[model samples]
Target: MEWVLLVIAGLCSGIIGALVGLGGGVILVPVIVYLGSVGLLDGITPQTVVGLSVIMMIFTGLSSTIAYMKKKTVDFKSGWIFFAGSAPGTILGAFVNRGLDLPSFQLYFGIMMVFLSLLLLIRKHLKPVHWFVKNGRKTTFEDGTGTYVYGYPIWFALLLTFGIGFSSGLFGIGGGSMLVPAMLLLFLFPPHVAVGTSMFMVFLSALVNSVTHISLGNVPWLYTIPVIPAAYIGAKIGAYLNHRLNSDSLVIVLQIVLLLLGVRSILDGIM
Candidate 1:
């Protein structure tokens, strides 16, 4: 029955993560932590929870990325560029995770999420010039449906991705929460492309982190194995839903999740 519950959690996490590009770890970690706290999930430490969540993220990210590719929503060019920085950061973050305290981590995570949520809410009031590129090498990304043109400061994005990668590695959150928002708000990427591209980048970063976790024996295979199939199916469904939603709807969905999760994490940390 516990296994069944985990499978359901995995299914929900996959669907939400794929739709927002936040990855399953955001949802899964909290569930795993709660179950472990209540002794429903035995022998599961925080490290184990993070490791297993990241492992599941591998499947979630890969499944959704593939679906996004089929829809031609992925922006491979930008994805790889950011990946160049994210890859190394992921490896380094995995190594650093051992040193952090759980409460401190949660507190900081909550603060970051809240800050980001406020930014999204007030984005319209802020000058677009402050958020978007004023002048740069314009790039055109062609998808199956149409073409998107945008300009971004390449150096800034690469540097920012390094920080995102480190956080992903440390927390096993797949970096999508940060990555998708950065792409959409700072890089001015189309909504669909941001979601698809975020998934692709997450797959790469999570793959690296998974290897690191597995090498360290942080992953609990027994706990992780049962949830994989459900997660995969959920991701496919999520990708389909992502395409159906318009930009405004997407932002609202992402904003609500961030706010709720953010408050939860903050309260958990304090209590």
Candidate 2:
């Protein structure tokens, strides 16, 4: 029954992560925490949950990235730039996260979720208003099937991704919740491009972070095994759905998920 529940949760989380670039941790972490809080799962520490979540992210991120790649929506150059900053941050966060107590971890997670939710809610007002680098490349690029007309400051992206990667490593999230919104609202990336690129970055960061956690013996492999296949299938479905939705609709969907996840996480954390 526990495995069944985890599979169901993994399916839903994968779909959301693929569609919105959230990386499934937003959904999975809270659910596992809630189960453990209620005594439904034994010996499930914060470290254990974070470790398992990263392992699941490896599969979801890879599968979703592949789906997006087929549609030619991923921004490889931009994704690599983000990964450059994210890698070290992820490593540092993995080591730092080992020291947090369960309650403190939950409280911080709740606060982070709520903060991300608020950002998404007011994202429209935050539009791409400033260009930090005037001499940056302004040319449009084609990704086989789709062409993206976007300009991004490489320095700004590196700065932002470092923080995002830190959060990903520390919180066991994909960092897409923050990355997707920043790409769209700040960098003006096309919605599909942001989602795809974010997935690629999440895959790389999560893979490294997962290895770090595994070396520390944090992952509950027995419980995490069933989630991978279901999450992979769901991610493909989500990527298919992402291509069909318009930007405004996608933003609305992402905001709603962030809002709900935020509320639930906060409530769980305080209680």
Top TM-score: which candidate number? 2
Model 1: per-residue Cα lDDT over 159-249, one tens digit each: 8889988888887778887777677666777778888989998888888889988998889999877778888888888898887765467
lDDT of each: 0.80, 0.83
Q: Write the per-residue lDDT of candidate 2 for residues 114-163, one digit (tens) a residue.
A: 78778877877875743632435454657556765676677777889999
After superposition, candidate 2 runs with Cα above 4 Å error: 142-148, 246-264, 267-271
Model 1: colliding residue pairs:
none
Give the TM-score of each candidate. Answer: 0.88, 0.91
lDDT of 1: 0.80
Best by lDDT: 2
